[model samples]
Every structure is written in C-alpha cells, then in structure tokens.
Target chain A: MSTKRDKVIVCRCEDVTLHQVDEAIARGHRDLESLKRYTGFGTGFCQGKQCVALCARLLVERGGDPPTKPITPRPPIRPIALADLARLVDDGDGP
Target chain B: MTEELTQPFDAIPDACDVLVVGAGIMGLATAYNLARMGAGRIVIVDRSYLCSGASGRNGGGVRAQFSSETNIELMKRSLELCDDFATEMGINVWLRRDGYLFLARNAKRRAELEASVALQRSHGLPTRMIGPSEILSIVPEIDVSGIEAGSYNPDDAVVFPWPFVWGYARACQRLGVTVHPFVDAELEATGGAMSGALLRSQRVESLGQEKHIRAPLVILATGAWSPEVAAPLGLELPNHPHRHEICSTEPLKPFLGPLVADLESGLYFSQSMRGEIVGGVSNARVPPGVDQRSSLRFLGLYAKALTRTMPILGSVRVLRQWAGCYDLTPDGSPIIGRVDSLEGLILLCGFMGHGFMIAPIIGLLTARYLLKNEERELFHRWSLGRFERGELLPESMILG
Candidate 1:
C-alpha cells in the first residue's frame, strides 16, 4: 500500500508521507481532522506548525469536505524547547 | 523518550487542587482564577516558557464588533475585562483602543458587511457601513482606488501581546500559585477517565536536582502542543498548528490608526505605536497541517497585498519578516471548558488566531467553570466534546 504515488508528505516537519495520511483516511476517517489524528500530520516537531493550511487545501482537493469556515490560528508560533524557554526568563526575558 | 503510563508511583504524593498543564495565557489565566478561589497548592507546569505558544506571537487585535451576536457579546464582555486589565492585574498591558476597520472591495462583501454591521449594532456594538468616500475620509492614507464600500468599527483595537501574558503570570504568582517552566506533564488515564499526571523537570534549581510534580486536576492550555500531550493518554484533540508568516515594514509616518483587514486577500495590517506597519497575509500555500519555517514567498505576498490595499505602502521598505504557527481547531471557535472523558483535564485551546484578544474573557470563563459548574451556554457549546457531538462553531470574521 505504500507506493510512490501514495507517498504524500503528511507532515512537512517530519516528512511523513501521503500513504500515511491516505491510509488514515481510508480507515473510516472521512475528514482532514480525523486523518490528522491517524496519520500524525499535525503532530510533528513543528507541532502542525506549517502543515494545517496545506492539509486544508489537500482535503478540499481530495473531496473531503473542507471546513466551511477558515481555520483558526493558535499561539506559540515558534516551538521552543522547554530548556531553552526556561533559560529565557533566567536571562531576563519575561517581556 | 518519555515512558508510557505503566505504574503510578506509590511513594510520591500525586495530588493537587489544580494542575495547569501548558503555561500559556489560558492556562495561567485559569490557574490565577483557581488560586483566587482558594484552590490551594496550585501548580502550573509548562513544557516551555510563558507565551512561548501562540499567546506571545499573535496579531493582538481586541474588538467588540463581530458578525455573530454570540461572539460580539463575548468580545464586548472581553473588552471590558481588557480595558481595566492593567490596573486589575497590576501589570501595564499596552492596550490601545485604536479601533478595527474591515474593508470590503466588492458589492457582495459590502452586503455581507452591512448585515454584519446590523448584527453588531443590534448587539450594542458601535459599527456601521460606510461608503468608499467615507472610508477615504476616515483613513486618508488608505487608497480607495478599487474599494467599493467598507465596514468600520471604531471600537476595535490592538495591544502588545507580551504584557498581557506577563499580567496573568504575575497575578497567578501573587495568588501563591507555583509556576514551573520547562516541566512536561505526562497525563495518564484509566477507563477513559484521566487519573493523574506525572510531571518531570530536570532543570530545577531549588535543590540543584531534578524535580517531579503530580496532580489530579490538570488543565491543558498548551495550544499547539495539545495533540502531543494528549497522545500519551490515548486522547485526540482535533487542533492543527498551521504556520502563519507575517512581517513588519520600516517605521513610517503615523498614517494608519485602526487594524485594517482586507476581506479579499486575507491581509490584515495595522501601524504599531512605533509607526512600523505590522501585519501579515494568509498565504495560498498554507494548508491544514504543521510547518513553521520562514518563507520569502510570504514577504512577497504581504508586499503585493498591502500595496493593492493601500498604494502608498508600496514604497515602504520591509524591516523584517517572521512566521509562527496557529493552533487551529476543526471549527473556528476555541475549545474552552472541560474534556468530558478526562476527570480533571480542561482544554483552553484552539483559539485559532484570536486568543490574544479574547484571553481575558476566556481566562475568567475557564476559571469560573473550574470553580463552579456555572457557565454560559457559549462555554457549553464550545466544549472539546462539541466535535464528537457533530456540532461545529461557524464564525465568519476570520483575519490574517
């Protein structure tokens, strides 16, 4: 089932391919939201950081009903590791 | 790698009145409220620093004017909270009530704006439809070449995101709440109910050693990190973190006052107090997934869209360009309140991109829900379980 054409980039950060997302979609998951849960599209090092909009477009093209409304934007644009983040405050970064 | 939940430590004390996971604004805000209500021994553990999530990196637009009555009420109440936030929280939050101007360039969009304005006015929001001639008169800097009509809400405004987080964090600290940065919480569930959480932090300085925290009541305000945190517990939160690229141009003369959102190109911009035009454009390539790398294409798109909206901005040199991920939910509205299956896990996430503006109200609402079962229908409708019930929140006022 993991063929060349099926190898879509599910997550750009981790580079998990399309077969992952397609397999997830084929497994009773008819929506991009569910496909993301099964295929790990949004769960990545970047934390779905750059993949959501692309996934929306892909879902729309793949006949999966796109969200009637536009996707919402959450916080923490950059995913800084716990250690680096803690140090910022110690180094006077509370602003 | 973190180990899966296999055994609960018998020796370590594993209970807290309230355990706040993810030290973002919502978590901190809720924790502060819990602390105020005498929820003693409150501990807030974050896998990262405060505002290291979307709270710090957002457009920071606060307005009472919304297309829907529910959102308008929520924002109106939220605006009141934000107005006195500095004195209430004893932190100087640089909130400027510069007003928000949503400009429509076509007849259809103009009609939509008129309807939204009527809705806003019906709900006591100071908004009205203005002709292109009036639009030009209000903000003369904005070129009205292709603009047909626009919706102007003078009550919408912007603020610095950093201070707001600081306000909540300081308030929480003053209320005797313990905040541990860089501590990751490993959530465990039994029979579909969250039993407890195991928090591990190796950078503790108190004893110059590692530290661990255990709590029963945990709130997940991790924003984009919610999915990863939920994975260990076999729970799924359908929130996607999409990287949104934005930029700032060199400090120009003070020309624009209100936040300008072009409904056509998904471009939103406002001149910061420093005179730099700070805003972003919704790129066409951004799909529903995760990637936070910066791109030159975003800068180009912003320049083109800005020039199209206002011709005078065409010659302004860009100062810098950056990108951040927006933790988006399936529906546009935020997933606030408790996760039903989890005994103590409350979700204050999926604000999409509007968390900063609504943080004050969300903080109060999430806190009240935790303290008492009493809550508005808005919270009930926006629960994380709403998706499982096939109920989706439909919000139309989406900006870049």
Candidate 2:
C-alpha cells in the first residue's frame, strides 16, 4: 500500500500519484509550476480550475515562495454547452 | 455573473445581422469589435463557455518577435491594444511585456537565429542576434554553459488570458452585442450560401422550450475544435488541437527578467510580475490529440529540460502545473478570412499556438473583413484555402 502522502492524486483525471511528484521534486523540481510540468499535476478536463489554487497552496507548504501577485486567470470558468452560449443576447436576461 | 432569464427577447425571438460561433478569444473579440463598429444586431455563440478551448488553456505569451512577417505585424498591432487593454476594456489584465529571449545552443540553431533576426530586422521589429557573451549581459542569472547564440526582443511580452477575454466580453456587452454562454451552435444553411445558425441545448425556463438564433453572417472562431464545428458545413479547415502543458513556480525574489526559450531543450521560462517563474517547454513527443488529461511522463520530461536549461531554478518550489490546447495548422499560421463558396460565413480559426498574442488585432481585422468585405493584405495571405493552393507559411519559432 502507498503511504498517506503517496496515495494523494495530484492529477485527478489522470490519476497521477503524489509519490510521482515527490520523485520528480527530488530530481530538482521543488515548486508547483515546474512540478506541474514534471508531474502533470493539474492539466485536466477542468483545466486546473479545480486544482490550481490547491496546488499553489501545497507548493507554499512545501517551502515554495509566495507569489507577489495572484495566479493568472484564463477564460471559460465553466464549460457551458455550445448551444447555450449562443443565446446570450436574445435570452431576455440582459438589462 | 448575471442570471439568464432576465435577458431581452420576443423581438422575432431569433435572428440577427451576424452570428459568431465559438466563444473563444477570437469569437468574443470579433463580436465586441463588430458591436463597437455600430454594426447591426450581432449574436455570438459558442460550443462551450468562453475559453473552453485554446484561449483559456494557452500559456498567454504575448510576443511580437514572430518569424513570419505577417504574424509579427499582427502581433505588433495587437500588443499595442494589449498595452492599453485594461483601460480600454475597463478590466484589469496583467499585461506584461517582459520580452522574449530565444537561446541557441548549436551552430545550426545560431545560424537559424541569425536568419530570423535578419527577417525581423527587415520588418522593422526590434530584434537582434546576440552571442553567449551578450546573453549573459541581459539575463545574468541564466546558465549559458552550452548556449552559444541568442535572440532578444524586448518588445515581446505576456499577459493574463482570462481578463483579456472578460474585457472583450464586457466591452461587447456594453456595445449592445449579445453574448451567450453554454449555447451549442449548429450551422443552419440555405441554398449554396450560408444563412443562419440554430443554437441548441438552451436551458432557459422562460423560453418554454429550446431557443433558436438565426443570423445573416455566421463567423466560426472556434479554435482547436473548429474542424468539428465546420465539418458538417463542408468547410474543411486544417486546424487541429494539440495539448501544450505549462506550469508555475512558487513565488520568488524576482530573478528572471525576460522570457527565455532554450532552442536546445525547447524549454522556456519567464518571471511573472507576481514574481512566480512561469513557463513550459516543447514536447515534440506528446501524442497529437484533444485529450487534456495530464500525465506523469510529461512531468519527467519537463524536469529534465528545466534542470538542463537553467540550473538556478533547482531550489525553487512549484506552485502549480496545467495543460492547454493549441489549434495547430499545417504551417504554424492561422487561417483568417471568408470561407470558400460560403458567402457571409467567415473563418478566424487555425492560429496554431499564437492566437492569444494576436487576439486584439485579429478581432479588428476579421471584423473589418466581415463588415466591409475589405480584406487587409496582411491576413489575406493566411486564408483557409492557402493549404490546398500550396501556400504554407512556415514559422520556425513554434514551441511544443
């Protein structure tokens, strides 16, 4: 059985293990961003919406530096259906 | 975050002067520009919410040092817009023009950099080919042991991707452009010419049933997923979605000043204004598909590359890691223009990996083409039909 820390899944969709992240970190990747590239921790269908903040906090706990600013936000917080996105103007919801 | 039911309706219940498909950066930016132009009623639709595709997932590297003259010009114009984006759109976007530094290791790569420098210089871009000694002068922290030559363009930059999209969406809303989220748009045609679109899967309780949107001009700005949306319409686009991964480091004492791209390892790094070192490398070995699921293999590859490129980052902690998709075309150039044979149907797709950097200018140019049929010479050469006609724009600076 994997250890408690090892059992945690960094990438939920891909089922990447935390041990894998630790191993990569041991190989000179100590932070979240680089750890992400080395471990594929947050790249998923949710596009890191679910894990980016969590990862950020984890990195801080792991002795990572706190960012002077917040993480960069991309668009489409939710994956709205293509059909639903087309009715914005005519939906009778605007002021 | 406004509720849906309260929007305006009943005025024919459907139809408009223009209907833009795919609510990515291109579609949203184009819609906002059209409305700003005082064009007749415009409705922008999407297969998913804004940034569902490449727009939301890209690394947000806004650089004007493109190998292609056309792309360089387009990005130069777009960078100008991004410089004043927050004030212009009334939104705060972290637009940072920190500059891009492409590091060359081997003699062959150095020669290529020299050639690219000549092209960029000819186009009036502030780019120069420097040697290892000169590179150390710019980024003193970077370990240039194996590196020989480099290209530095201070004008190239980066920006936060989300606020840019929101800025455009808000601007479009203020200009009276209809913005719809979660509306799946289907191409509804008539005769040989494109007519209107049918928005499916609408979840409004007040409409009594699903809603429909019929517009005169239909624009497809769906980045990576564009081919699927255009397939049924018989419009063959060469855009395919490729997964590109990026990650961030725990904030640190700002060290890296410019975006560094190591041509040897395909690794690039930049320090965010927030002091977090953020960047990614080219994975030529990544499987070519739309699958966004992260993998352990990529992590291993990235670690090796970063360690080899700049050993100074060995002690830095990683804050987060994520993957994004790129709408890749045959020649690394975007196909922007009116579709063949389909009147009133325009395509602003196939930006490959450079769409986010040029969204602002592309929006204006595409709107100009659709509104006045005035095709700018810049984007005219990047038409969708160029592939079949054997005209391919090769951009060597493309990262993985």
DockQ per model, Cα: 0.02, 0.02
User: What are the Cα lDDT values of the candidates?
Assistant: 0.69, 0.70
Judge candidate 1 at residue A40 and give its lDDT.
45
Number of the predicted model whose TM-score against the real structure is largest: 2
lDDT string for model 2 (B1-400, tens) is 3312112223223779988787778888888888877788988765444555677767778887767777777778888888888887776677777788998888998888888889888878889988778888888877789888899998888777866776777677677776665567678777767778766644232233356776768888887778888888876777788877776655678777788887666677788766767777666656776766554445445555665566666666554566877888888888888667787778888787888878888888777776676656655688877877898888877775
RMSD of 2: 13.8
Q: Which window of 10 residues has the lowest lDDT sum in candidate 1 chain B?
A: B2-11
What is candidate 1's lDDT per residue for B298-394, written digit by digit as tens?
Answer: 6666666676577766666664455667778877888877677777777788877777777777778777776776785767899988898998877
TM-score of chain A for each candidate? 0.62, 0.59
The residue ranges of model 1 lying beyond 4 angstroms of the native Cα positions read: A1-95, B1-14, B202-212, B287-290
Candidate 2, true inter-chain contacts retained: 0.00
Please give me the total number of clashing residue pairs in predicted model 2. 34
